[model samples]
Target: MKKRSIIGLTMGGLMLIAALCTKAVTPTLRLSDTRPKIILGTAIPTKFGDWQEDASQVAAVVNPTTVAELNKIYAETLSRTYVNRQGNRIMLSIAYGTDQRDNLSVHFPEGCYGGQGFAVGQTSQVVLPTVAGGIATSRTVATLNSRVEPITYWVVVGDKAVPNSWEVKKVKLAYALQGMIPDATLMRVSSIGEDIEQGYQLQQSFIDQLLQSMPPDLRGHFSGTSH
Candidate 1:
């Protein structure tokens, strides 16, 4: 009986120590509180390269997410429509959240469009070339009746950018392991057209120009800094 008691006590002590270690290493630091805040309105230009804000079409680029839900999850959201010299218009939506831990993950366009009765197509991955390097992003098509929308998007966690929705959680966990909770930004650009290929080309052009237009640090915020 004495030997059994000693073994039981040792096991209990080991479990207690393990729990304490876990509690100690668990992330409590919030990088959002220290990092510079992203102001969506000014971060993206209203005019860059050959494109300018199509103010008349801005009202059409509405998010399916309700205002209350957006307020609960996002720190800031920007929605606009821009037209290039060729009259091609692209809808831009950006959502930034200070904390992506728990239920605050940025609402992806795939889910938002699904909620709005659009049939979402398979998503394709693309790597956009930038001065900082290549930014991995996802492109997909959503169709509803006569309207077909092709969207390209990426998520920025801390200084890292990821295109996959599942990868966002991985990035968050990596940050948590370092005892820091990283902020996240979701930037989506879509255009209404049946020719998905052409739509994507226009979007890539707009995105490249838009990133180039921003100051280096601001550009780094979205595409990351490491060349």
Candidate 2:
């Protein structure tokens, strides 16, 4: 009976020590209260350069399952179609998550498009030069039947633009270690056309002009730079 009692005491003491160590290592952190000050709809201008919002058509380009998933993950989402004077139309989608953790990260267009029955093809990394600095972006061409859509998209994790999943995880872990729950946004611009090169060029031009027209303070939020 004494031996059994000593074993029980030793196990309890070890469990207590483990619990104390966990408490010491785990960060005592919470998301900042003043985050996500810039609203997506108001920050992005309605009319920039020759591009204007197309009010006639309402195409979100997201499937029902993805939409449902997004509703749970993101705090806000904006989907709009913009047309230029030369009849070039681009679909713009932005999703913002207040808490960008592993389970609640922003969804990329490549996977989302694949989920929506679109065949994703030929993905490449591209650098888009904004007024602040050069932001790394991903370009992918998605095809569905006769429609070919060229997409340019990027994800902003914390204050930096991450190009791939590996970078995203690194950024998130860095923030986590600093006791911060970083916010993230996924910005995507796509156009349906035959020439993928021209489509990407136009999208870049659109992004440049749009960034130029935005407020100086708010530009960093989208461009992932303080400058």
TM-score of each: 0.90, 0.85
- The weakest ten consecutive residues by lDDT in model 2 span 25-34
Q: Model 2: residues >4 Å from true position, as ranges?
A: 1-32, 63-65
The whole-model lDDT of each prediction reads 0.87, 0.81
Model 2 residue 215 lDDT score: 79
lDDT of 1 by residue, 122-227 (tens): 9889898766678989999999999999999999888888988788878888888888888888889999999999999998888888888988888988775542
Clashing pairs in 1: none
| Candidate that scores best on TM-score | 1
Each candidate structure's count of clashing pairs: 0, 0
